[model samples]
Target chain A: MAEKKMGLHTIKLKNPPSILSTATIVGPKEGEGPLKDYFDIVLEDDLFGEKSWEKAESKMLREAVRLAMNKINLSPDQVDYFFAGDLLNQIISSSFAARELGIPFFGLYGACSTLTEAMSLAAMMVDGGFADITIAATSSHFSSAERQFRFPLEHGNQRPPTSQWTVTGAGAVVLGREGKGPYVTYITTGRVVDFGIKDANNMGAAMAPAAADTILRHLKDTGFTAADYDLIMTGDLAKIGREIAADIIKQNGYDITTKFTDAGIEIFDLTTQDVHSGGSGCGCSASVFGGYIYKQLINGNLNRIMIISTGALLSPTSTQQGESIPGIAHAITIERSLEK
Target chain B: MEKRKENEIKNIYQQMVQKKVPQSSLIKDAIFAFVVGGLICDVGQFFMNLFLSFGISKDDVGYYVATVMVFLGAFLTGLGVYDNIGKYAGAGSIVPITGFANSIVSPAMEYKREGYIFGVGSKMFVIAGPILVYGISSSIIVGIIYYLVKVLAR
Candidate 1:
């Protein structure tokens, strides 16, 4: 009744929330990647002097959140809500980081799709007149994810070709009621889609269907073709998933092949990086969008972008129990505010 | 009727995924495994010869050779060299006694953060524990069969 809903699954905000500031931090491996200069902080070591990988991941999330707020001279008390998530069990990284910030927290677990989950929800809160300023943050450390999801650090096991390297990083975005430019205009909440994919190594394959479903629905709702947006970025779809998603989207009558780009494929050089397929995890999309794409928007290098972050919701126990992975994707349209 | 259509789509999607995924060559992997695994065994044989030459009894040489190989595996794992070797060698590295050593030592090194007692001591056998349990139990069964056969012969 308040705002005109675009169709099923699409939210058209009456008042758009502005992206006030963004900060990104990554480990040495990601810093060595192509988007090295974009990140605010490049950790020389993965551990960052923590005794355990979990602690290190928590520290990175905290630092990125603080840096985002500090850039605009806003304190933790100023931010009305905190939306944070990570790949760790119980999302310990976000929970621990949230403890230190003393902000009201909404702990999320959308797997690799946490960034958009945080962003879209934060935008909703800001547009609804509930809060003035909000922060959306997520983190994923390679070692932490490995121990929690795969194997111990020293465990000698070969990664399958389908496997992706989790980006060791964290990203934070501070959103406000009014700002200069780069406003969160629309959110397309994803529905859970499962092709009953069982192989966790092929996460890109598992999530590709959801990525296609969300993008197709968003386009159908908004009545906009793929040509309308400058870029349509999917989070951590990597090589195989990106291809499969593109194929599926085209089959559904919306051809986004030209405009489509995946944060997973963009974050690392596939041939040389030894990241078999490409970079993945929540931080893959988070670090890419929060650091690189945000800068491009500010510089007017890009006009409009639809970021559809995908998640393959499979826990270690579920995978062991032969439960199929259910994939989800959430999308947000961030546009450059029209200049006067 | 709706469920059947969903099943059809899922089947089509699965096939597409299989095509897109890069296939690993089994023959190529096997070659690497044969070479690297053979080298590890050669080193074990060398140790056996070395221990025998050192005036250690033939009976004691097997024990000494095993200790040396296990020590080497643990040392390389600690230095973070074995993981790299294991990557290329695949089962070549994993099929040997050194692999057994790696199975035990790797988890111990990783879990050291949780502390020596609960972390290292308990998790040390996590990978190799099932093997030891089954291996010993099977041997007891085999030993009892031999005892019965000897008694029957008498």
Candidate 2:
């Protein structure tokens, strides 16, 4: 007997329109009243100060998770599992944050790509029936990251043109059974690629090749072309990185033209701002995905989208050892709704 | 529940503000390092913006910025400022372009006593070489496509 062909069992979002509740906590904008109704918690602390950044970052993550759970009408106990990570030493911020959330947690690290990685995993878990609800989150504070990874914010250091402004914020998103919102339909994971560039300051160029590599894989795996989605976005590959990614894609015989954009470059109005290329940090993608794109989804301006979060896997020790900067990118296909 | 975390933070803050390590006070050192490091980046940005105003294309900005940063980083390393910054700010001094330069050169300089070819010369470009290679290659490939588009569009 021929087996009946069932419709695609990919994690499909149920409602055609998905509402996003977002919270942004930047050092400059801390202490402000509620960013929005759905967003309830906002913590004010600088990670780079002589104070304890990990502690503050942990609290921020907890706050973001708490708000996300409340906004989604889910209890912390009800969130079957927590998938989270951050740009902290040993991902301690994520681990600690998850501890407070009190959910079964799986800690992940993809540098700035942590949010998308969380989303991809959470979607699969929900789709596989391992969990009915999950939360994906990430946080990065410029001061804290700088002190731990670079120079202190008060230091009179110079940044390279390829540098990105690591953002100071944490964002969370809750995923559930395809009821109402964007569904993670497919994912393409990329192998790390290093073209021997070791300048951590110039991360965009270091990470672009990986972005190009994964986007190509994504199109191939899903049998979808650039036209399949209205927008194709890459995470944290700022201005220079985006240009490099575009060039690589063009060389590979696919031209994204003006339609393709990178979140790092798009997040800020560069002309009016000194954030040379654009924003970086785990929050760079997390906030853009949760705050900006999620809104567009609810507005029905976007139906299908492919988001590839690119990460530069460089550490202080590796940079010191003269090792090349290797990059990894993860892509997730999102549809407007899961239900037919 | 939140009060415990807040109290913990207060204790850490008090310790950081009051205590001095062997070389200097932790808070003083950290603050000094951060200020100096930030000023360096501010100056770099100023000049970079200046070059852009002088009509330098964005394509060449990275190399120029890198060169200037290398000089400053090497100078800081020589003055022992970077080391002090490291003691205080920890990762702060190491995360910027200058820090990257220090990472590349300090090792190469240490290895110079061993030999030039395997040590200084070869190791000098350890951190930035592959990125340049890939970047240049990708740019050239893209440039060729742009040329083709220009001709084909006509």
Deviation (Å) of A62 in candidate 1: 0.4
Residue A15 displacement in candidate 2 (angstroms): 13
Best by DockQ: 1
Chain B structural similarity (TM-score) per candidate: 0.87, 0.52
lDDT of 2 at A304: 80
How would you encode candidate 2's per-residue C-alpha lDDT over B66-143 as one tens digit per residue?
888889887877665765565445546766778767766565654454478886787566545665689799999999
Q: Write the per-residue lDDT of candidate 1 for residues A1-340, one digit (tens) a residue.
A: 3464888889988889999999999999999999999999999989988988999999999999999999999999999999999999899999999999999999999999999999999999999999999999999999989877877766667788999999999999999999986999989999899998899999999999999999999999999898889999999999989999999999999889999999999888899899998988889899999999999999998899999989999999999899999999999999997542
**Residue-wise C-alpha lDDT for candidate 1, range B30-146, written one tens digit per residue:** 898899999999999998888888899998888999899999999999999888888888999987988889989998988888899998999889888988999999999999999
Model 2 residue A243 distance off true place after TM-score fit, in angstroms: 0.7
Predicted candidate 2, C-alpha RMSD: 19.8
The lDDT per prediction is 0.92, 0.70
Predicted candidate 2 versus true structure: per-residue lDDT over A102-148, tens digit per residue = 89999999998888788878876776677877788888877668756
Off by over 4 Å in 2: A1-24, A29-51, B1-154
